[model samples]
Target: MDKQTSRNLWRITAGQRLRYASAIAVTGLASAFMLSVPLVGGYVLDVVDTQDLAQGAALLVEAANTLAVEIGGKPYVAYLVLSAVAGVGLTALGATCQYLQGRWAAIASEALARRLRETMYERMQHLPASFFDEADTGDLVQRCSSDVETVRVFLSSQVVQIGRSILLLSVLTPILFARDARLASLALVLMPFIIAGAYYFFAKVREQFKITDESEGALTARLQENLTGIRVVRAFARQAYEVEHFGSKSLALRDNRERLNRLSGAYWAVSDFLCTAQVCIVLIAGGMFLAAGSLSVGELFAFMMQVTMVIWPVRHLGQVLNESGKAMVSLGRINHVLLAEEESRDPAPATERVRGELVLENVTVEYEPDRPVLKDLSVHIPAGETVGIVGPPGAGKSTLIRLLARLYEPQHGRILIDGLDLLEVDRHWLRRQLGIVMQDPFLYSRTVADNLRVARADVNDTEMMAAAREAAVHDAIVGFPAGYRSRVGERGVTLSGGQRQRLALARALLVEPPILVLDDALSAVDTGTEGQIMAALERRRGRHTTIIIAHRLSSVRGADRILVLEQGRLIQEGTHATLAATSGPYRRLCEIQGALDEAIERDLKETSNAV
Candidate 1:
């Protein structure tokens, strides 16, 4: 399909068409039974037309006498009694058929909703992070849930109702024309105006419903943002400000709902008026024909029955149009996300082991072209080497770490694992070779073992404990009553900052990657705990390659090589002792931090003396 056509929600859910067609078939069957009622009534009236009142009374007396005989013994009388029983039986059959038709529609609606939600979630997982930056989470949630429900309602009701109405009209119109050509022609004259009015009102409703759905999305997003940030608002003393902001969003949504209500009211009022007027006209015209002795009393009665069938469908057409309008708008919104590009990568399956030699060659990255963050920067770390990167805030430290993981692509230049370029290698394979422990690591609301398994799914409990011991966090983990099975709460809110960071480090260690990157991961721990973790890391020196970015000078002091950055440029690359003794950004930074520490110690001592 062309891109323009691809955006339609109906395309992904084309199965719904078959579902609708099935419902239409059942509705047609039920409507046929109802149409038979009018035909039966007409046939009875025709029988009346053949006889005078005395003859008709004699015919009824004969039917009753036959039924009485059946109760006693006559076979023909039994047949007459059975005919009345069959008519009542057909009426009950028609009611059952109608109920089945509605039940089938409900099943179809529920099935479509389930299929659509699953497809939407799969699409979401594949979409790139850039897509989330542009879309609101709550709005996306609403589309997957509320918007799908709207379409389902239309599928269950409007779709089948329209089919039944058309079938009823088609069957009755011909019968009416056969009975009396003049009255049929008069009734047909009002049809074009009625159809035109329905189409116009439906178009108006469709336009309003689009705005209403959009307002709902915005309202849901606003409410979500407010609730998620409630703690921040309370801390900042912004309760009144937040309340007013939320109220404004709520008011806008309410106004949109009111607009829809007004349009809906106007539409039904006009439709009812037109239908009632048409019924009145048919009654008056038929009465005149009856007075002229041009039409028989029984024939006139049958014509009136046909007219009732015709107008009933016309009255229901408005309801069908209204529901269909709402469904169309909802489908458009839901399809918007389902049709979005699956932005994550998938490649050939990868193995369990990888060597960790990393190389960056003339790398350049930019969120937008002509404003590069890292320009023509290149570095290489052999397997099992420890390299420390020191830089001021916003010196592209995190950007470099992100490139190592392929979170994004560099605008120009290449990154490689061992000798194979990262782009050419399977992303899963490349990621498996490396582990990252970040400054503010994210943890799911799951057991400690559950979170650790994200790194390497096959790791057993014994292996997990060993990895935790290597990260110097085993004592802390076991200190909790539940131990490794303890819940972390959302984002690890239940854990202290130091404990969360230690858990993250242990998770990375569990993977046993050839390369490990610590992006200021030790910033949360105390000096003594930090020392122990570093000592544990030192014991694993030749077993894994490590890249460390540190704010604390002591953290990177043991690195075999140190790279210093200022802005996006690497200005110094040497051993820690060499950089501290020589002149450059690294030496200056060390001297400044050293003086600050001394001053803090002096102030503490003076405060103690005064006390």
Candidate 2:
């Protein structure tokens, strides 16, 4: 891993590095204890075959003499039994260490995965709106889930195996040379080639892993979109087309995955061949040393056993290096989200409630360069005044409210809420002070009461119902199978379009924000129902600063002042009576809507008369 990647991993592994450190120590201890088994076997063979306790090294001779009690057919029998016990005991201790190593690795990896998930979720919550606008929901979900799993697998398995490979080499190489330096050199001649080949394969496959990850992400993103819009797909009878598109994404993912697997297969094949060749070379050379009477058969056996230990780990490392590449790529993808700049947060969020006085001075905004959405727009709505904003589509109506909520900063001028710059006030605090209901509002797949209570934690049942009643959605909610306990299915599909909007409106009202914005939020309701909700809002007059953005003039006909927008500029501003009497966009819209309504009314009457 590079220094930056290692640093990111260390940062994420906070509070759990000690556990990993312990696992590493345990792995080393396990390797040392387990490696002693071959030596014990070699020592017993030497003593039994030669029928002398002094045939092998002086250390074993002295230890065997001390450990063995004579209850023997031959002198070495008691020593043989003692050797069995020693070998079993060492193996058991090593196994125990192995178990501890696995447990610690698992615990640490799980903790890291949990922390990764929580950090991603919290950071996403604070990320600026533009991040979501440019990010795919499915790709982000995969990063949080699949990418975390990839890293977890690496942490739990590959990380410890890597430490084991290093320990095996560092500890065993010295022992091999100590036993017989000349033979040990021959045994290790092919080992460097194995490691070099593993890394060379690693370098080749890293880019392929990244490509496979991207393909999988794209597949999931397309799948998520199709599932979310299943209704739309079925409504348009586009199942075949959608299925074909999904198949293509799946095929791309499959092809990329197969390519990655091919590369892995080639690595394993070459590494396996190299490992076998090294083992054969060590054995052939040990036989030559034995023929020259310099190497004992028992010692040769021990050398073969230890060389196997070293050779297998070299191959094991090749497999782990592949996992390391994927883990590194996943870490990079996840870190991107964790490092992206979050929405602005004030060190000390404004604690005082805003008076809702809003001022826009020569405010210019643009989503794209040189193409302003709201151009030099200036307006002021004092506290407790009811204002209406109306414009055709793409006239910057929604942009204006978002600016007031501080979702986006103005490029040319500043917005003030109660004499404080929008940027100066905390973004979270400003949003809480403004209750906004969009045209197609979203509802959670939860109980009606839960969704309503989500807006204000302190809102009791009584307050919730009152707000719902004001939005004219209380009766509909009560009519559900379980009343307030009834669950609204995903995105509120259980309710009509108008109910979703009104329920969202009720949620906003529960906040009792000083600034209430209804951005064409009543388009789905009939005029009669809109009138009932508007009448309820009327009772709130002079108590809240209300701005209603509506395409239907009737929704905003009674406001104190109406502002009409054309393109990105404010072209007209007045009350209903004043604007209607004048010839401008407002009057032209009223005339066009009036003629359409008359035509619809006549058609209905003629059809009823014929019946």
Q: Which stretches of candidate 1 lie over 4 Å from their true place?
A: 1-10, 14-19, 42-69, 72-88, 169-171, 294-308, 312-315, 344-346, 349-352, 603-611
Query: Which digits, one per residue and each the tens of the lDDT, describe model 1 over residues 1-611?
Result: 23543346345447666766777787777666765555544444544565432322244446655666757755333433443554466677778877887887788778878888888888887676667879998899889988989977876777788888888788878988888989988877677777888788888888898898888888889888877677778999999998898888889889999999999898788878887788788878989998998976656766777787788687788678777778877887876787677645656345466567778999988877687778888898888899999999988888898888877778889997877777776666777888899999999999888998988899998999988887778898898889999988888878888888989999999878899999999999988899998998999997889999998888899999998877777788999899999998899899999999899989999999999
Off by over 4 Å in 2: 56-73, 347-351
The local lDDT score (0 to 100) that residue 395 gets in candidate 1 is 85
How many residue pairs collide in each prediction? 0, 0
lDDT, residue 297, model 2: 79
Candidate 1 residue-wise lDDT at 465: 94
- TM-score per prediction, in order, is 0.87, 0.97
